[model samples]
Target: MKIFVDRDKCQNHGLCAISAPASFQLDTDGELQYQESFDDEHIDDIEDAIDSCPLQAILLHPDAA
Candidate 1:
């Protein structure tokens, strides 16, 4: 799956990180960073992150590949 975050809509909250640390993280600067792609095994975690995002900035897309 592919993950996209609308930076303009994101508040840099760490809930995504809390839900899926392997896919999302808050850098030392407290900025949100995330992987653009992940293996199928990570879908559940990524979904949790998407649902947990308070700003609803997280988006999930089917992998084009």
Candidate 2:
């Protein structure tokens, strides 16, 4: 699937990083960084990351799933 983090809506809370380390991470500067696409094996982790976002910034689109 495709992962889209709305930069304008994200708060760099790092919840996504906690939920899905494989796809989301906080850079050295403490900024949020993520993969635009992920494999099927990571769907559950990705979904958890989406749910953990307090700002609801993570979006999962099936365009590439």
Candidate 3:
């Protein structure tokens, strides 16, 4: 699956990291970081992250569908 985050819309809220720590993270500077590509097994967590994001900055590529 492919993941993309709209940096301009993101607020660094860290909810995505809480929802899917394996795929998303907040660095020491409280900035968001994530994997662009991940294992299919993490789909549930990735979806959870997407749902939890207040800014709706996360998106899955069409290939992820």
Candidate 4:
């Protein structure tokens, strides 16, 4: 899957990081950083991250069928 974050809408809340540290992180500046694509094994973590994002900035896009 592909992950996207609306940087303009992110507030650096770190919920995404908490939910999926392997895929999402808060940088030294406390900005959100994440992998653009992740393995299927990480889908559940990514989903949790999407749900945990307080600002709703995280988005997931499955590959085109």
The list of candidate 4 runs beyond 4 A from truth reads: none
Pairs that clash in candidate 2: none
- Residue 35, candidate 4: Cα error in Å is 0.6
For model 3 the TM-score comes to: 0.92
lDDT of 1 at 54: 92
Provide the RMSD of all predictions against the true structure, rounded to 1 decimal: 1.1, 1.6, 2.2, 1.5
For model 2, give the 10-residue run with minimal summed lDDT. Answer: 56-65
Ranking by lDDT: 3, 1, 2, 4
lDDT of 3 by residue, 1-65 (tens): 58999999999999999999999999999999898988989999999999999989999986634
lDDT of 1 by residue, 1-65 (tens): 58999999999989999999999999999999999988889889999999999999999877786
> Candidate 4, overall lDDT?
0.89
RMSD value for candidate 4 = 1.5
Instruction: Please report, as a residue range, the 10-residue window in candidate 4 with the lowest summed lDDT.
Output: 56-65
lDDT per residue for candidate 4 within 1-65, as digits (tens), equals: 68989989999999988989889988899887889989889889889999988889999877677
Give the runs in model 2 whose Cα sits over 4 Å from its true position: none
- Clash-forming residue pairs, model 1: none
Model 1 clash number:
0
